[model samples]
Target: PASTQRHVKSINKRASGQAFEVILKPLSPVSDAAHSLPSPPKRDISLDDIQKKLEAAEERRRSQEAQVLRALAEKREHERDVLMKAMEENSNFSKMAEEKLQLKMDQIKENRDAHLAAMIERLPNFHGPSTSLHPTPSFSPALTLSRADTRPWRPRGGGPHRHITPPHTIMLTTAISIISGYKHG
Candidate 1:
């Protein structure tokens, strides 16, 4: 029986335009190889990968938006805090000013009260024993004169007596009468 020989051929080409060839011999089939061979798997794709990427991007976007919103909130909160602080300070200042004014008013009232108290203390007591000051004049009905003596009294009806001498002439006549009486005495 002739020997069965397997020949391999190969070819190569060089940079100088040479050519090269290679030949491979097929191997003999093994029993049960089909069972040992692995089949080509279908290309696999998992929804988890795309979903994870989407989730990561969404998370990043959410984080960025949250940061922006947080910054805005913080700014508003800071402004509110500043406004509150200013209002509190203003209220405190006003309260202090009011207290100072009230204190001044209280001081003025106290001074006025003290002055009034001193004045009251200085006033003489009316209910105490009377001291000798001036002698009171005794009153007599005979000392009272009517218009007849001071001036010539005219009667109610426009009738007999109507003496209307000027005050100066009456005073002169009374002085002359007093001088003549003193000379005669």
Candidate 2:
């Protein structure tokens, strides 16, 4: 080929620093056997093959989607089961607590009732004599009071003659003093 003829070249180099010229050779009379060989025949693809491939791909996609959906469903079911179990446990715990509380209340009531019964049994030991509705001269002490002794008693330090300031007036006076001191200081 003309391209092969143009590429034919030879290079020579000497021990010295000088470089020889590149010499191109003439084209040889060689036959193009490699190019003359027959090429492989092109195989035709049928429409059925493409359709089968598309159906296979579609089936794979459907299978993958189904798997994902199944996994999601399983996860949801597991979560629901866990939630139900937790709720059941919580309810059971509450019921247990309520039962315990009721038991404690019953115990308290029983103890209280027992204590009341014991107190009632001991009541007669501390009971005093009950006096009759009418006063008897033999059982009562006689007293003779003059008219001057009938007046109500009064405290010695605080009487009608003593002058005392009201508590609110004292507090007000103290507050005024404190405010005046603060302003002067």
Candidate 3:
């Protein structure tokens, strides 16, 4: 019985020593490790530092804006150059067209003048009664033969005769007669 009691006491003391060792080992390592690690670096942030950073950011933004404005100005200048070039081309085309029109008008005027000169050259002068005539006095012409003569005469030549009967004149006379008859009716 004495030997049994001694064995139990020895077992209890071994268990207590193991528990104490487990607790003390973990605590000492944790505390020592915490103390050995360096503390985090101190940061003394000031309002001046924040203001300087903000100013730097603002300067960068301003520079970007300036670059954008310069690019826009260059683009506008290029566009203006293109527009001016197009305007110049249009003006040149217009000038060419005007010149062509003027040339055509000049050619038309020259042709008309030449035709008039030819017509004048072919026509006979009628200042006096010595010109050719048919000598027939019974035609009862509508226009006077001359300013001095009371007899009327018909044109004899074929070149644009002044006394030629117009087709419209017959139509006009018929229309007038019909209108007069309708009015009487």
User: Each model's C-alpha lDDT?
Assistant: 0.60, 0.59, 0.56
Model 3 bad stretches (over 4 Å): 1-42, 126-185
2 or 3: which has the higher TM-score? Answer: 2
* Candidate 1 vs 3: which has more TM-score: 3
Q: Rank the candidates by TM-score, best first.
A: 2, 3, 1
Q: What TM-score does model 3 achieve against the real structure? A: 0.47
TM-score of each: 0.37, 0.47, 0.47
Q: Mind sharing the TM-score for model 1?
A: 0.37
**Native-to-model Cα distance after best TM-score fit, residue 107 in candidate 1, in Å:** 0.5
**Model 1 deviation from the true structure expressed as Cα RMSD, one decimal place:** 25.0
**Model 2 spans with C-alpha error above 4 angstroms:** 1-41, 125-185
Pick out the ten consecutive residues of candidate 3 with the lowest summed lDDT: 135-144
Best by TM-score: 2
Residue 89 in model 1: lDDT: 100
